[model samples]
Target: MPHRSSTLNRRLVRYAFATLFAALSTQAAWAASFDCGQAKQPDERAICASRQLSEMDVEMAVRYDTLTGLVAMGTRGDMQDEQRAWLHERAACRGDRRCLRASYTKRIDTLKREYDQLKSRGPF
Candidate 1:
């Protein structure tokens, strides 16, 4: 009985260590997702940055859709052009994987221009 108990204890310790290691590795991967700017390898950096941007793109798309719908219903026009510009920029960014950084910057510039235009049109 004592030998059996010792074996069981060993197994439990092994399992616990395994679980801890797995959890740590998972946390590391998640941390990698946020360390985009600190990635050393080009591919790694690109992947990390893409993951971050992809998340932003999804959120921006949702907001853009909602705002555009409001504009269509004449409930609001403040975000119409702004959302359109964002969509355009996101599209541009998604289309070219090689120039993701540049595309993002261009998208920002486009959004700024659209915002300026919308502002000139006066308040909605």
Candidate 2:
């Protein structure tokens, strides 16, 4: 059996790697979806200003992209329209960082769930 200290160390390493993976995915999401230089909305500006919000935005974007690609061709338009509506709702949160963060969190969670559904599908 493994020693307690070694087990603790292994768990810590896994946690660290998970954190690192999340950080990297969020960064890529931000870069892939928006040009920070031209960000105009209050929420966009706020996202650009805060690391947490920016990370959420990126994470959500990545999940959205993945889910969209995974879903059927016939459903693509609906997915995109739903995303647009969500964006409008998110933007309505305006300068409230808490509201914006909550919005991002909910959307990211939803998209992540949808993305996970792809795991059961065969590779095309």
Candidate 3:
């Protein structure tokens, strides 16, 4: 009767929220730093194609951006150079998933170490 209708409405609302959350999570998981629609390079295309690589790209971009913001001007320049070098190295992989994964892993680790060092030196 009325109680059943109320219960059904509550369940419907919960289901809708759950569906929305799941969709957002899935979209976020595949979101990389660069635009997939215009991806031209083989490496870029491969990253766009793979969920795992896309997630790693997002992680690397976030860490790199966060670190760049926190570091001094000179340090930031050096970090940018390092990132450029890493990008070249990653591009050399040219759609090789294993190589791309390894490169991302190494770059992420390096960024993390740098972040930890900055933390140790800072009250800023």
Reference-based TM-score of each model: 0.32, 0.69, 0.79
How far residue 42's Cα lies from its native spot in candidate 2, in Å, is: 0.8
lDDT of 2: 0.81
- Extract clashing residue pairs from model 1: none
Question: Which lDDT values do the candidates have, in the order given?
Answer: 0.54, 0.81, 0.94
What total of clashing residue pairs does each candidate reach? Answer: 0, 0, 0
In candidate 1, what are the lDDT values of residues 2-66, reduced to their tens digit? 99999999999999999878966653433432355575654444545555554444444454454
Provide C-alpha RMSD values for all models, in order: 13.6, 6.9, 6.1
Candidates arranged by lDDT, highest first: 3, 2, 1
Top candidate (TM-score): 3
Q: Residue 41 error for model 2, in Å?
A: 1.5
| Residue 25 in model 1: lDDT | 69
- Model 2 weakest 10-residue run by lDDT: 24-33
Which residue pairs collide, candidate 2? Answer: none
lDDT of the structure predicted as candidate 3: 0.94
How close to the true structure is residue 80 of candidate 2, measured as C-alpha lDDT? 91
Model 2 per-residue lDDT tens digits across residues 2-118:
799899999999999999889677744444258888888888888887778877877888788777877788788888988999999998999899999899888987877766666
